[model samples]
Target: MITKILQYYRGFVRARIVSHSPERFLNLCRNHQIILQDLVYRDGYYECQMDLKDFQRIRPIAHKSHTRLFILKKCGFPFFLYRNRHRKVTYISCALFVIVLYVMSLFIWDIQFEGNQKYTDDVLMTFLHSQGYVQGMKVHNVVCEDLEKAIRNEYEDINWVSARIDGTRLVVKIKENTGILEIEEKNYEEGDLIADKDGVVVSVITRKGTPMVHKGDTVSVGDVLVAGTLEILDDSGGVMAQHRVQADADIILERTYEYNDYIPATYIERNYIKERKHYFIQFFDYRFQIFPVEKKENTEIITTKNQCHLFSNFYIPVYYGSCQERIYEETEKSYTETEAKQLCERNLQYYFKNLKKLGVEIIQNNVTIKWDVNGCTANGTIVVHEKAGKLSQEQQVEETMKANEYH
Candidate 1:
């Protein structure tokens, strides 16, 4: 690839040789250290490509080998410049573009982040901006080591961070601490565990409190599942003393989620007519249109912009691309019964998928879809088993005690 690029930068040519001693001609050319590429022999003639400099030297060798050489084609940058020598404005514009790109390369144009899960791109970018490490800042102003350390310090979840400048882009890669961090257990005030939703109790495992509800019991929201107070019974079945503690337990419950959705029978569909192509160039905040675009009603404009870049990660502020104006007509349409049913089923499946994401185990789905002349309706319930318990301040209960019981 390097050699081909060098050849193009200098110049190259394809020449045809008609000689009886083709083997001798090749040997002489090799002896002179002239490299020939894509050599082919066809119909008693030899054709090959050589650099322009090598082509010039091959003339003497061709004479010595009693061969006739004819230049078939000229290629490469030198030839291109010579052909366009008369166009002064084109050359001047190209030179100015190169200068502009060189200037743009001195500053950061793009910021990219990778290997991020807990922190999103916007969040990370916002942090960087707060630290004065934003796009369009001078490349020299960015200290990679400082940026890496700052990120790791800012986000406790991120254990490792790598920041580097690739061309004009600043790339940051981070590895989040996936392992759960252990927290010191603190003595919490006495509280009771209550049901946050109406459900049937599936199971209860009391760790540090008295269980108030058993399995198969139907409970409503705000009902206490575990009591924070514990009572000590005497041999005669009398309350000897009472101990109050915070409730701690794992409780599972089966709950039902009502699902209801309806879709209108009529919808508007777009009918495409034709598209008009437009060209534009943008430099920083200013944009220039190559051609005038006529304003039309009921037309959608879709634009694509491409930033100027010399290589990967080396982006410039200048952007150029095309815009397509899509002309379309809206038509009113009605959904068929089959289509409505399918749409309703799709919505139902999507709801179930969201429920499963929240660690809810689906037990049963009793959804029914009905299609009528007006529209489609899906109404039913979904049964799921999920963890159920929320901490609530314990209600103080007054108890009568004799002074002798303390002794």
Candidate 2:
């Protein structure tokens, strides 16, 4: 039966062609032993169909002619089934996606905050959540302007703030308050300089206090410079009150450290592969299912969960992503002291380089220590060169240190 249908379709198949010269068209087809079927003459072209056999017969001449032909072929059932599968999935998925997107458009899945440096993300999110702008809330149910006004009224440290909905996450940007303290300058006092470390005196700069030593003066740790002359003969030939000042100086020292390590013969390593699967119900972004979700110990292995939403089409997610985690763990064997010291030295040098930025110059450095039967430990002292001047009280954020005042 299918063969007969195909034969009929082939016998009267429809097509179109263009030919400028009628005589040439007739001669060309005749030369190729082909027949013309259901011919038309309009717009310099013919519209018609032809049997495969007839078309093949004239195919040779048609190849040489300036004219062109287009044939309308019938679709077979296999072709129809194949196309229908794609169209069906697309149509059904699209239809479901639309309804789902509309419903999901009303709900919120995530919230985010940006442009916040002073406050942690958790803190900002907590504040936002208390304001009714949290995840899983209906997106269309809240007005963000009112929320911002409320937040500004509640938090004095915030100068300016704004909230926006980007897909499922609400991005809250904020500016923090910065104001200088109001203080009046007072009468000044002079102080002395004391040795912070055991080193040779290099040089000292006394702003208000008198200097005690010049360059190349050796000093022990805790030695004082710039004596506070309290009972001094003034120009009036009388004893005058002593004044305190800060004796500032730069001191550098040499230091050393070492590390010990033990080598292990075997090591343990862990590897992971990700398997992703997603399911939907009613083609909406309302709910989801994840397998093997039971919480357990040895969570050392971290599992990250990400969620995305689609408000436009169910098949294409438009919302930003979210992630949750589970921890994974692996232990590797240890190495010998030489290997450990190399590793420790690499890290130690990295840290020491940062300390140099604090204005301390290193005159010399040495590292000597190792761990074998037990863990490694190191011990060393720093020696710097600097001069001393009179000291004063320096007030700072944490604690106030007094120099000449201590004496």
Candidate 3:
């Protein structure tokens, strides 16, 4: 491979020689120190390859050997240049393109995360950016071990992490401790089951310990739903032996979430104008915005940035895009009753979505819309059924100390 590559750069030629005595021609060429390679004997001629300089020297030897020599092919940089001499501009552009690619390869252009179930891409990217790992950063400066250590230090749930560079892209792989319990859940193992929030218990099923609160019971935050005491009763319902354990129970509650929002009849509406100005520079994976834009008062600016890759998908160091700053002006606008109601409904729905994310199952949603002269007011009461119990570690410790003192 090395020899072939060097031959391409230094230039070489393939030629055939016909002689009455081929052995004599070969000996003459060797005696004159003319280098030859891949020599093959055909019906009446000897075919071989040699360096460009050797090819020039071969003619004199062929004359002495009384042989006929003809170039079968020319292969190398010199020949290539001669063949495309008229298209020098095209060749120079291609050379520049390769140089640009080399320069771009030195910088990191993309960051990717994998095996991340709990953390989001934005969350990981933001963390990476905060650690000086971002697009356009020098690839050499990135230390994968340092990044992995930093990530492990910052996120306790992550058990293992790996940061590696693939071309211009940085890939982060993480293995999180998904089986780990939450703080409240772990506390519950060592204490009585208490109410996490104020709610009406809809159902209660005790697995261990004694049930303190039954179904349809109203419990406040910190109130024990199940006691950790296990009582042993004799024939006459007399307490003989008692034991304390970690209480366990499944308590579903009907919790209500109230959200109040008022939408103004007259509000400022912002709209971006399509006119924009952009200036950008790109070489390989490097990108820079030449023109800096500012947001004017009472206006919103939207800047869109994009990077380009080679062959549409293959990432190279070359990037081409424009930052379009769409200037938006705000104007006073009045909302109709119907529009205000829709906005209020959207707000309520957004609140419900957030609740659902917490594993709350919505049993009923009651939203009351009040239309005032100025605007509309929406009051929402979302009744959700969800597990309702939390363990108070401090209280559990206090209770244990008190029981020890009493004993």
Candidate 4:
């Protein structure tokens, strides 16, 4: 019949028994008319705790009656006291050491790197450190824009670079540049319409010069569509110095159509062999690109990977890895007349799209191809007249940079 109210104190009940005689201690209290009371342990000894008022009345007969000690809790459970001072001290020390070790790891010491193709992770780490983001350098030392610029400048051979910090890992990625473009555009003044492709001249509008063709006229691709200037001369009709100009033209093309019939169709998967990326290791402002060495040929690739700069702060992760994917489609040649025709149509459509940007209109097109039991060959000509205007904004912006700038 115990209630939970008394449980909070871990209270237990015991009947007090004090007897020198073992038999007396074993004797039942009620049978012997002995008093029953509470008991407690003190200093390795049991003390009978009777009410003071009751104690006085029972004190006289206490020696005659054997005192009994019996627990009153519903379940008489053995108790445990706190001990083992040495064990507790050892546990606390071990826990403290582990926490200290973990906190220390938060401070990176040495950074390592891997999965690099063009540049070594160590080189990037050293460069980053020199750029104020090295071992012992607080994370805030490298700004995103600054890091991006630094990587670009340091690794000229890499066409692109990216840098970031993931947890303690700093990833710097580099891509090799694979494009080789003509450095300059040829300059021209005024010239006559020539036959680049036999085509009829349609319409022509001169933007900054004079027109050389009107609608319903036949011309070629290289045929001059516009004149760069007006003819100026002295009183004697002598020629003057010609000024450089962007001769505009819109020469409608002349074309032919021929066809060959055949059977059987084939499909093939093609891979592009051209790709570009730039990777570098920069120390302070100076940088080096290990990949994209001179005398390399046909650099197209499918994927480019890079990692963040490694540093001496944490040897575990110098930088995370990154990659870019590029896919190329091969030009398929089909023996089927219908499929070949579709392919040629698509090609012409794409060509028209490009010509539209040049102020040219493709009013009509005639296509024909030759086919045999072996295969089919398409022989066709595009009739387009285009005019030249101002250079594209992007091109002008690029032209403004006199030289490649680096940090």
Candidate 5:
């Protein structure tokens, strides 16, 4: 295989030799160190293939053997170049295409987002555009670490972010701040733990200070559940001294709240059609789609962006892509009783999930779901038991006075 390829590159010739003694000619050529391949004798002629350079050296041997050599074919890169040497435009166009493709690959062609929930692609891209990270810009101009840092700093809800380049595509990943609760800070100054809302006290655990309320006690908003001041009693049961400290406690309260939800049976929904228009824009390290005209009301538009490639996954930063805006028209959609019920259940699940994130424990939930030809409604009473106490901020002057008194 390797020999055949080398022979083709160096140019090879297939020739027919008219010789009375074909076997003697072949032996003489071999003895002269001439490389002859595919040698065959047929119809009173010797046929064989040899390198173009060796073909020239064989003329003397053919003459000595009294054989007439005629080239049946000449093929290879060298022959092709010689055949098309006069076509200047073809060669120039081929060279320019390769040079252009190589130059385009040095910049970004596409931007993609992953693991994002609160921030949309448009929002993230807009922010990146402001940072001079746009599409069609050289990859060397953009720093992945700096881009991640900028995104995290601008969006407080993003807990972590990453930026990376794959081929000509710029990939951005983000982890939003969700579900996790903030840690409570420690306060050394005197303060009281008061009821955050009016509810029945289900349970209480005092970690510091004194508990002013007990289980089954009904409290109102702003009422102190735990007192921050401690009184020292004398032998005669008289107050000897009083000291103020920060109160810390967990006070779980049982509360009932009304939950109501309504979903219309006949709703307007968008029906997308195949009609599409494309618009492309490039920023430094980011590229996106833009609408040339104003979008239609009550229509749903879907846009898809892809990295442009020169050939066979060989992507280039010069994006030549289109945004297909699938035009959609509003249509009336009717929901059956079963569908309405399913929708209501989904909403209830979402609501409960959010409540659980706030550390609320559901003690009882009695809900009623009803559906009609017009719509569906879900009404219920949710009884949750949760911590009802929060620390009240102590005034600056009072804190100073307390500190002085303690000293």
Candidate 6:
């Protein structure tokens, strides 16, 4: 492939040799170190392609072989230039286009992110913009090591980051910490674990602090499940001092979640009439239309764009593709009883799926859906077993101690 490209750049020719001694001619050409491509014989004549320089050296060989050479076809850059030499303006425009492309290549045209889970592309791009790194910035200004460090410092969950420049694109790859995050012991402030929802305690395991509730105990929102202060005792069993620490515990509880959802019977449905397609070419911000676009009401335009690139990762700002306009009409429609019930069930299932994603174990689903002429309604309670505590300030421990002293 590379040889062919070089041949085209240097120009080449196909010549027919009317020689009685074709074998001798070929041997003489080879002995003279001449390269011939696409050699063939047909109807008592020989034809082959050779570079212009080699063709120039072939005249003496042809004369010795008693052969006549005829230039059948000329191809490649030199011939193209000679044929279009009169079109000076076209040549100038082409040179200008190449120069523009080269200039654009010095600046970043696209910014891409990979291996991101918790943070989205927009979030990362926004951060980069705030740090004065953005698309169209000079590629030479990008310090990949600094960018990686900045990203790692900015996002706590990002465990590893790699930033690199690929052609005209800034590519950032990050690996997020998927394991459970642990708080540093030095940063653990005095706090107590309190119930964030109403539930019956299934189990309690304390890692630090005094347990205020036990298994099978009923708890309400804001009630302390574990106290952050421990009562230290003297030899005589009197309280010597109260040592304050952060409360750490896992409390599983059986809770009921109230679920309610409804959907209207009447809805708007779209009926597509026809689809019209138009092609467009875009250079940076300017767009040129290849086909005339018609203006119509109640139409949805879906466009697919493909950016121009020299190869992988060498993207440019030029884009071209097709836009499809789907013309549609809206009509008022009513769902049947069965359809309404099915939709309500689907919504209920989605709610359950979300709850399961949060590590909730559904014990029982008592929810039911009913459909009437007006709409569908789902109402009931979902029984689930889930972790049920959040950190709260340690003021509750002091209050509990005062209450104990009063008693």
**Cα lDDT tens digits for candidate 5, 1-407:** 99778877999999998988877888888899998888887888878888889887988888888888999999887999999999999999999998977777787767789999888988989999999988777988879999998998899878788888886778888988777556456765888899889899988898888899999999999999998877676666766666778898888999998999998999888776667667776543566556553466654455544545656535654443465556667888899899999999899989889999988888888878998777999998999998877788775333222212222
Question: TM-score for every candidate vs. truth?
Answer: 0.53, 0.37, 0.63, 0.28, 0.58, 0.62
Alpha carbon lDDT of each predicted model: 0.88, 0.56, 0.80, 0.49, 0.81, 0.88
Pairs that clash in candidate 3? 104-285, 284-317, 284-318, 285-317
**267-384, model 3: which lDDT tens digit per residue?**
9877866667777777754557767666766544554445556643336544566665666677898998999999988988888777777678999878899887799998877788
Candidate 5 vs candidate 6: the lDDT winner is 6
Cα error, residue 185 of model 1, in Å, equals 10
Q: Comparing candidate 2 with candidate 4, which one achieves the higher TM-score? A: 2
For candidate 1, report its TM-score.
0.53
Off by over 4 Å in 6: 1-98, 115-164, 172-200, 216-224, 228-247, 390-407
Candidate 2 on 1-407: residue-level lDDT in tens? 98668856555456677666656866877676676656666776667655667765765566667666676664444445555775777778878978976766676666667677778888877877787776667778767798789878977777788977766556678887543322333433434466655545555554434556566676666566554333344566654454444444443333232333233334466533343333333223443445434445434323333445444212223322322334455667656677666765676566566556544455555545566654454445433322222234454223233333322
Tens digits of per-residue lDDT, candidate 6, 222-309, equal 9999988777766667676787878989999999889999989999999999998999999888889967566678988888888888
Q: What lDDT does candidate 6 reach at residue 62?
A: 88
RMSD of 3: 7.3
Off by over 4 Å in 1: 1-108, 113-198, 207-209, 216-249, 292-295, 390-407
State the displacement of the C-alpha of residue 137, model 3, in Å, after optimal TM-score superposition.
Answer: 6.3
Q: Candidate 5 — what's its lDDT?
A: 0.81
Candidate 5 TM-score, true structure as reference: 0.58
lDDT of 4 by residue, 1-407 (tens): 36443332343333344456534442433454544444455554455533223334454454465543443332122121123344777768878978855554454334444445757776777887787776544455546678779877887776666676654545666666443322244443333333455545444545555666666676655555565555445555654434434554444443442332333456665777544554554443344555533433433333333333334332332232222223455766655666766665566566667566545555456556555565555555555444322221111111121232335
The total number of steric clashes, by the backbone 3 Å criterion, in model 5 comes to 7
